[model samples]
Structures are given as structure tokens and as C-alpha cells.
Target: MSRKTLNLDSTLYDYLISQSLRETPIQSRLREETAALGGPAGMQVSPEQGQFLAFLASLIGAKRVVEVGTFTGYSALSVALALPADGRITCCDVSADWTAIAQRYWEQAGVAGKIELRLAPALETLDALVSEEGVDKVDMAFIDADKERYDGYYEACLTLVRPGGLIAIDNVLWGGAVADPANKSADTEAIRALNAKLKEDRRVDLSLLPIGDGLTLCRKR
Candidate 1:
């Protein structure tokens, strides 16, 4: 038996997806469309990661959610699909071009009515949420925006979610750069700082899984 996470080569990865992934046709179509965009398509979460987000939302019986990044809305769609009919998710992003693609798929998915897209700087949207919704009202939050401001987003989400609420942060490993001392680029440094901070922060129970680019699951205490 393995003592730690097994490294997934392309073969193993494909096998894993073949065995476990349950992507819907719409989801698959969206993924294909996003992939056609080339490099930027990498910003979208893997199918497994999207499924995990949906699982988390369902686990908590989440009624209200917030998303700090809404790239093509795959993650949002995943979570939206899991929410009850009355549930709502506020999505924050700045790219009209990208989110427009998201809107079409969301409409097709029939979850468009549940999502509120705020096209502005994420920080602004998050701050406004804190003012309007107050502390501990959100059930879950997913953060995947600008790496440099991750800490700020984390703090805001921490306040937005109640005790036992969840905040899922994407790219904590920053494509494995956080572990390499030589990669001191601005984005890498920011992610590294947040990783270190999250490890010690007693306000939340944390787990950094070896998922897509590393996903940090933080349950607020």
C-alpha cells in the first residue's frame, strides 16, 4: 500500500479519470471549448476538482456561496448544480469576455438564475459582500483569482463564512513553485506566504491536498 500520495503520470491520470470522473455532457463540452482557448484554459479546474467542490457544497448543505474567481464558470457550475433550488452563489471576476462564455454554459445548465456575476476587481466585490452580508453568513467560498492578493481574499472569506464553513483556495502550490526556493517570482512568493500563514493560522482547520495545482481546504473554526 502507498504511504503517501502517488505521482500520477499521464497513464495513471487517465485511468483515474476513467474510473472516477463523472463529468456531465455540458461540463465536457465546456471543458472542450475552454481547452480550445489554449494557455488560458489551464485556469479552469480539473473535472475531479470541480466534483470535489460540489461534494463540499453538498456536505455542508450550503445555501449561500461566494466565488472569488469565475473563469468560464466551471467550478461555479459544479457547485451550483449541487445547491438546492433556493440557493445562491455570487461570482466575482473582472473579465467580461471570459465570463460571457461562462454565462452561456450556465444558461444551458439552467443554473444561471442561481448565479450573480459581479464584473469588477475581486477585492472590491469581496469587500462589498462583507459589508452587505456581514460575518458568518456564507456557507462556502472558493478562491482562485490573482495569486498576489490571495491572503486578502482568504481573510475576507474567513469572515464571510460561519464557523464550520469552508473556504477552498486554488493554486496554493502554484504549480509546485511554492516548494522551490529559487522561484521567488511575485506570484510564487505570494502563494508561499499564504501557504505558510495558513499552516499556522488557528482560525481554521486546514488540509492541502495534492489535487489540481494543490487545493487548500480550510474549514473556519
Candidate 2:
């Protein structure tokens, strides 16, 4: 057996999905609709990533969740499905156009009642959460918004999530640009800086996994 993570080519990746993924019909249709939007569709998490988020929430017995990005609502839907009937998730997003698409799919999925869509600047939404909910009130949080503001999201999530709760940050690798010193774009550098900080941050225990453009999981201590 290999000691390190295996590089998955497309064929192997498809095989892996065939063997392990359990996407529902609504999820698949949502994916297809998002894909039809062309380049912007890439912002949606892959099916496996959505499943993993669900698994994490279920594993933690999470009932209260927060999402910093709700693009078309795939991830939110996934997690909502795993929560108990009384559970809820507050989704932060500014795009009415995009989240409207998300709202339709969420309604169809029958998880609409479980999700609250906040259409405003994400930071404003997050800060308001801290004020309204107080610290340590959230069970889990997912961050997948603007790369430049990831640190802000992470900090807010750190405060919101209870001790031992998790904060899952998406696109931590920024398409592998964080490792390339020459690729010093603003988004890339912001992600790179967060990666470095997370590695040493004493407030949480971290793991940077090589899943879905790199997902960083921080369990608040």
C-alpha cells in the first residue's frame, strides 16, 4: 500500500465515484443545472465533497450550521439532509441571482425550511451572527466565499463554533497556487497566508486534506 495520497487521474476518479459516491437525483440535477452556467459552475463543490460535508455534520451530531458561501446550495443541501428535523443552517451570500437558483433546488429537496438565506455582504452577515447568536453557538461552519476574505470568515467561524466544533474551509490550495512561490496573486497569497497561519494556530487542531481543490478542516479546541 502507498504511504502517501494517490494521484487520481480522471479514469480513476470516475471509478472512485462509481464505487463510493451516493448522490441523490436532486443533487445530480442541481449539479447539471449549475454546470450549464459554464465557468461559474466550477465554484460548486464536487459531489464527493458535498457528501463529505454531510458525513462530517452527521458525525458531529450537528444541529446548528453556518455556511459562508451557498453557491446554488449544493453543500447546504447535503449538510441539511444529514441534520435532524429540528436542525437549521444559516447561509451567507450576496447574489440574489445565484442564491435564487439555490433556493429553488433547496425547496425541491425539501430542505428549504432548514436553511436561512442571508443576502448581504458575508462579513456583515458573519459579524451579525456573532452579535445575535453569541460566541460558541454554532455546531459547524463551512467557508467557501471570496478567497481574499477567507481569514475573516475563519476567525468569525472560530468564534461562532463551539469548542470541539469544526470549521471546514474550501479551496485552501487555490488550485495548487499556494505552493508555487511565483504565483503571487491576491487570492492566492491570501489563501497561502491562511494555510501558514492554520498550521501553527493554537486555537484549533488542523488537517489540510487533498480533497476537492484542498479542504482544510479545523476543529476548534
Candidate 3:
């Protein structure tokens, strides 16, 4: 009872990628570096996802973008590289270890100046930002942090994003487990509940794409 498109083998996935345009050299190198790092090679966003995010950022003309997770900087760099010359992105992550790698790649991408890396619990940072007046000014927000706190992040983002802005939450499908009633794992349950909540929430217009672990996009109304 899960999403079928989510189940593609390595060979088929590679074939699908081969059919599409390839990433630039710098992006390819970044992928290689992420692969070498190992433990969470999958943490890096897919090339298609990166390109899509970049286009989305540019389309919104986002000046003050916020990313809840900055694993090895791939997503941050993707957004930063697309931002306007005067644009800036705030990246939140708690691990110095993972972000250290992201820092190097951001420098290599020449986008380090456009990104501000904050090392702290994402929820705390989000709450603090919301607490500051004149700071409820985010044009876009990307949430990909702790599964258990997904709703909390969504609420915080609802307050943080501009009326017409977007909140892109990653892993909403949780590898299709959200649709599988039999899979009762904690992460799966969290995503399932969050999906149901968003589906009924009239505050935003929602679209759940079967892309990279399933990306749920919500635009503020």
C-alpha cells in the first residue's frame, strides 16, 4: 500500500539519471565528496532535487531563505548558488562534523559568503528567529530535521514565512511508509501524522511530490 514510484533499484535509478541531463562538474565533485564521506551519502539531495530547489529559490526571488538541515551543505549550496547577488541563506545544523564538510564544499562552490551557518538545535534557532520582530520575514523555509519535531517546525515556519512564501518539508513520505498502515515505526508514524495534518490544514496549499524520499511543498495562503 506504499507509493510505487519510490521503489527503484540502483541500476534503474542510474538509468533514469542517465536519461536526464547531467550535473555540472562542480556539482559532480560535490557528489563525489559526499560519497567519500560515507555514513549518510544519501543525505545529499539528488541532482534533480537540487536543480529543482535552485529554480524554486530563483523563481521566488528569495532573499532571506532558511534551511532547517544543512547536511554537508549540498542543499544549502544549491539554494545559495541560485540566490540573487544580494541574497543570503541561513543554514541551521547542530553537528560541526557534518557541517565542516559542507563548509569546504560551500567554499569550493564560491557560495560561502552567501550562507550563514548556525550550529544549534534547529527548533531553538527557529523559535529564536520567530521571537524577533521584523524577522518573521522569511521568503522560503526548508525543513528536513528531526522527524519527531516536524510538526513543531511546520508551525514555526508558518509564523516565519511571508504570506505568499513556501515551506518545503522533506521526507514526508518516509520511503512510502506513511501510506503503509502496517509500518508503525516512530519516524514513519510521525510522517504519516504530519501528512494527514497538512492535507487537512487550510492555511496552506499543499503538494506532495514523489521526489527524493518524497518532498511535501506547502505554500502559505
Predictions in order: lDDT: 0.95, 0.96, 0.86
Number of backbone-clashing residue pairs for each candidate, in the order shown: 0, 0, 0
Q: In angstroms, how far off is 97's CA in candidate 3? A: 0.6
Scanning candidate 3 in windows of ten residues, the lowest lDDT window is 1-10
lDDT sort, best first? 2, 1, 3
Give stretches of model 1 more than 4 Å off: none
**Judged by lDDT relative to the true structure, which candidate is superior, 1 or 3?**
1
Candidate 1 C-alpha lDDT tens digits along 50-71:
9999999999999999999999
Considering summed lDDT, which 10 consecutive residues are worst modelled in model 1?
171-180
lDDT of 3 at 156: 87
Tens-place lDDT digits, model 3, residues 1-221: 76564557999888878887346677788888889977788777888788778888889889989899888878888888889888888888999999998898888888889999999998888888888635459999999888988899899888899988999999887866788889998888888889999999999999999888889899999
lDDT of 1 at 92: 95
Regions of candidate 2 where Cα sits further than 4 Å from its true position: none
> Which candidate comes out best when scored by lDDT?
2
TM-score of each: 0.99, 0.99, 0.91
